[model samples]
Structure formats: C-alpha cells, structure tokens
Target: MVHGGEEALMRQYAIGDEIGRGRFGTVRRCISNATGEALALKTTPKAPLRDPLDLALAEQEPKLHLLASSPPCSPHLVALHAAFDDADAVHLVVDLCAGGDLFTLLSARGGRLPEREAAGLAAQLASALAACHRRGVAHRDVKPDNLLFDAATGALKLADFGSAEWFGDGRRMSGLVGTPYYVAPEVVAGREYGEKVDVWSAGVVLYVMLSGTVPFYGATVPEIFEAVLRGNLRFPPRAFAGVSPEAKDLMRRMLCKDVSRRLSAEQVLRHPWIASCGSDAVAG
Candidate 1:
C-alpha cells in the first residue's frame, strides 16, 4: 500500500498494547479493522523539536524504510506497510514479527548459538544487507536487537531503518552514529565512511551470535571507543573452540580495520561461511 494519510491510519487500525519503546516513540501491536491482520504501529510524538538533528533523524527513518521496502530489495527486510502523521504523533504501520528479536533468542539460548544456527542467521542478514546496499541504502545499525523472526516460519527479517541513510552516489557519510560496540573503527575515529561500516557492524553481530560476546569491550564508552580504534580482532580459545576456521576468516574480512579491505555486503554473502548455510537458509 502507498502512503495512507492520517485519516486512513486512524480509521483502519485498532491500536492495542505497547510492544516496545525507543527514544522518539513507542511501538504497539495493532489489528487492521478492514482485514483483521496484525501489524506493528510505531508512533512518534510530534512534540516541539528540541534538537533539530533529532527531528531530522525522526523524519528520515520512515523515508528510509519506505525506500528499502521498494522493489529490487530483498523481502527478508521488514516491510513498511504504511505511514501517516496526526495531530500528536506520526504512525508507521509495519510487519509484526511475533517470534521476537534475535537478542531475546540469543539470551534464551544460553547467550550463544551453535555455529550452524549462527551461520544460518548470518546468511540471512548478509543477504539482507546486500539487498540494502544494492538499493543504495546503508543500514548503519545492524545489531542483534534489530533482527526479528517470523513466528510461524522462523524466518529472519532485518528491522529498524532509523539509523539508515542513502549513499547512492558512493559518497561517505560523517557522524558518530551507531551502537558503540558495533561501530566501525573508521566511524569511531570520526573519519568519513560509507556502507562498509554496515559490514563491520554485521561482523560484530556474527561474532556475538557465534560466541556471545562483543569483540571490543571496556568499562566505559571512551574505553570502548579506544578498543575499536585499536582494531584488535580475536576469537578467544574458550569461546571459539568449536567455531570453524572459515567462519573466523570471514569475520576477519568483514571486520578489517581498513575500509578498502573490508568485505562488501555482497562479498560477505558469498564468503564460504555464509555460502555454506545453503540457498534455503533464509526466506526471501
């Protein structure tokens, strides 16, 4: 569906319980009165703009999601069904992933997943990132929390385009955005960076999924930033004893400190580790 102006938004869906919360809004479970289909509604308050940058980011999110949902992109990406603005807030109606996010799944699985399972998830995510990059969109934040699964099928879907930006021209974007633990070394160093940053973050996601620990750690933000700049990539003996050498090799390629050396999303998708997951590993 195309953009359904505010009237259609309020008239079509019966908003229900709050499912999640973010800095700018709350995500709620809703049901479409017209079709009785379940949906996730993200409502962001239209309060006065205190920080102009925050307002710009809030406005950019829905547009990015819309772009990614268009043709030529992978269906593994979460769909943005519709969006509209009202007197008090803006509502974004998206696909509801009842199976919960990867973070929750990881926690429940004793904080780590077997290599095969992690590889399956990584294959899906790498494919999603390839689609996003092909469409000229960079999903700067690619953490486990942003990965959701379809309840009935257990298919993974990439969610949250709030930190995404268009980079169609192959130009670098500036700004220290993204979670500290997953931020690329170039990004943490305040250097102009491009979609390769997404690859780095995805590598972190892969590492955490397989080993259940972040590559860079510290007691404070500054310390973490320092660790990232130092660019030390390691697979501790205990955590990586069972991990395949090919998996470690792929991780190293994706997390390379030099942006030019870092694997593109497409390359990551073709890496042996991801490719070994097989074509049916993730749903399109």
Candidate 2:
C-alpha cells in the first residue's frame, strides 16, 4: 500500500549522490538528519510500471522484507529501517553495504574463493535464508549479485527481496521466478514448490564459490535449463580435486533432483563444513 505523501522522507534523511541503479529505480546514499548516521535509500518510481507482476512485486517487496525482519532479526539480513511512499515513488531505507556484492568479491579474488572462506560465506547466506524460511518467506532469487558486504567489517548481508514471496500456512508457491543459473529444477519445470528452492540456489552459490563454475551450465538459457532438468550434479576432478568430500556431499544433497531428499537451510547449517565455520557465520 502506498503511504500517501503525508510524511516527506527527505525531511528525515537528506538524499545525496546516486550510488547504484536497478530496473525500477536508483539507490542513493542518504544521511539521517537526526543522528548524522549514513544509510542507503532506494527510490522506485511507480508511474512507468504497468505490468501486473511488476506492480505486485513493487508492493510485495517491502512487506515481505518487514515480515522477515520481525523480532529476533538476523544480522545476515540487510536491515530495512523504513519504507516511505508518495505519488511519485517508493523509498526504502536500509543499512549501507559499501563493500559491494559477492559477485564483485569473486571477480576480485580470481573467480573463486578458498574452501574455508567459501564455507564461511555459505554459512552466512544459509543462516540468512534459514531466518527467511522460518518466517515463511522464500527468497526466490539467491545469487552473488544480491548478497552484499559491509564497508568496514566486510560482513555479508542478504539483500533485494523483490523476488521474494510469502509461502505461509504450509501453502506451496507457484510461478517461474529466479535467475536461470541459480533457479531450481522444479521451478524451471513450472512445478509448485516451497522454501526448498532457496536451498537449491544457495547450493549453486556455494558450488560456484568453490569451483568458479556452475554445476549445471550451457551456452544458452535453454541448454542451462536442460542441464538443470537432467539433474546430473558432478564435481570435475580438475576443479574439485582439492575440495573436501564433506563439502561435495553437502552440495549433492542440496542439488538433489528429489525435492524431498533436499536438505533445509537449518540442516545445511548442521553440515560438517558449515558447522566448522559456525563461529564465523551469523547465527542460524
């Protein structure tokens, strides 16, 4: 619901230079007028949006994000302080992540991360997804691009709930949503699925971190979808020779073709590799 332009968001936070841009709008750096603290402000204009799904997403994002941030909020999540609305745009104030996203981190580090570091990052993402799942919110899009890092501490935080959906009441969610490289097979097949899809995507993220390549890949979108449908998970000896067996086993369970056999986020936290990195990861 759009909060009538009754309260001016600019009165609370001074909008500054543009920092990033997305499909719907731009993200700018802003500072609180009261405490002199810095934050990020996302402004999405509503005028140009006419598609039903796009409009639905613009409204659902803030609500689902707030639901996931209820009592006992996870630090792994990029805390959204408030959301403001007007006739022109929707404003979202969230914690600033100046260290960039996981994609940038991977690119800077020669396309792959060491096992211990990968485990730590994976554990953090898993913890974040676990918190989202408990609240019945499924983050349909779980990729490096949406995982941001802090400026000073370099801590990881999951962001961008635009593709997230509410799956409460034990109800299954239907619809083809998510990035092709990270989307689950069930999702690609247009099947009704639940929170487990997040685990599958997270598994793909972890696999990419460790091997610097996707498990199911192709030259085109159709080829990639086909490979994902076949569900043949493998660890090329050249890329996975140094990887531990436990890590490989964990990915196997996560990328399993049988949704029932897939492990949940909480179970992923209990995995040996993730468990060993628990101290470094945010609470699950």
lDDT of each: 0.85, 0.88
Q: What is the C-alpha RMSD of each candidate to the true structure, in Å?
A: 1.8, 1.8
Give the clashing pairs for model 1.
none
lDDT of 2 by residue, 1-284 (tens): 33445266877888899998877888999998889889998878888788777777877788998898766889899888778877777788888999999998899988899898899899889889999999999999999999999887777899888889999999999888888899999999999999999999999999999999999998999999999999899899988879999899999989988999999999998898788754465654
Q: What tens digits encode model 1's per-residue C-alpha lDDT throughout 1-284?
A: 43555677868889899999876788999998989999999887868547766566667778888888776557679888788865666688999998999999999999899888888888888888888888788998889889999887888899888788888877778888888899999988888889999999999999998898999998899999999999899999998888899999999999899888899988987887777763458665
- How far residue 43's Cα lies from its native spot in candidate 2, in Å, is 2.0
Model 2: which residue pairs collide? none
Give the TM-score (vs. native) of candidate 1.
0.94
Supply the global lDDT for candidate 2: 0.88
Deviation of model 2 at 178, angstroms: 0.9
